[model samples]
Target: MATSTNGAPSMFSKSNYTWMLIGAVVIALGMFLMSGGKSADPNVFNRDAVYSTTRITVAPIIIFIGLAIEIYAIFKRSSPEKK
Candidate 1:
């Protein structure tokens, strides 16, 4: 009997999907941080610390968006041409 080698294509694979999601989340976080400007709180711990932490939290969102774009491009490339 012949063994089946069928499997999901790279774009649709679990690993790829997970990575894409992670990337999107990263990018989103980055955007959030950049847009946050600086913490406006007058008495919450430290202003700079809060601002910096917010900025750091945003890095992932940027990364995630890039990954998602890449995945979209890959899928587009693999799609069959319409007759």
Candidate 2:
């Protein structure tokens, strides 16, 4: 639904920007998940907290998903504006 009136075509549509925003939010959520795992005592290390499935496995997956979304956003082509 976006065609530049002038000769040049717009690089991205509103939909593309929306997807990019979603992707960025997903990435931030993944980072937030990875950032946690603080132990109560600094000296004593809690292996479980450090190696939890959410941090090691899930977060990276989430981040990758976000990256994929970002890639999609970048590559997505705008549909031709209907008459």
Candidate 3:
């Protein structure tokens, strides 16, 4: 929608907000999978398994960062404050 004569666009637009929420959830799930929901085992001796676990261990932190970025984008797109 176009901005009102006063110059700021509506803050309640559904598209941007909806996409932001969807993106956050997708990121969370992706991170969970990356960390290995049911397949991760620390005791496995195979080289590939060991490497996978190592990557899995770092998934949460990466997810947190992704969440932060998504939130930041939402805030950045917020309507300008009226004076």
Q: Rate the local accuracy (lDDT) of all candidates.
A: 0.55, 0.92, 0.61
Report the number of the highest-lDDT candidate. Answer: 2
Model 3 ranges off by over 4 Å: 1-12, 37-43, 53-69, 76-83
TM-scores, one per candidate? 0.37, 0.85, 0.39
lDDT by residue for model 1 (1-83), tens: 11225743343444445556765766666666666444466555665664665456555556566767657644643334245
Q: State the lDDT at 60 in candidate 2.
A: 98
| TM-score of candidate 1 against the unseen true structure | 0.37
Task: Report backbone clashes per prediction.
Answer: 15, 0, 0
Task: Write one digit per residue (lDDT tens) for candidate 2, span 1-83.
Answer: 57567967778898899999999999999999999778888999999999999999999999999999999998998888778
Instruction: Compose the digit string of candidate 3's lDDT tens values, residues 1-83.
Output: 43666978665455556767776886777566575334455555565643675455566666776687677656655445456
The alpha-carbon deviation from the true structure for residue 38 of candidate 3, after best TM-score superposition, in angstroms, is 6.4
Candidate 3 structure, TM-score to reference: 0.39
What local lDDT does model 3 show for residue 41? Answer: 57
Error of 2 at 16 (Å): 0.5
| Backbone-clash count (model 1) | 15
Which regions of candidate 2 fall more than 4 Å away from where they truly are?
Answer: 1-8
Rank list by TM-score: 2, 3, 1
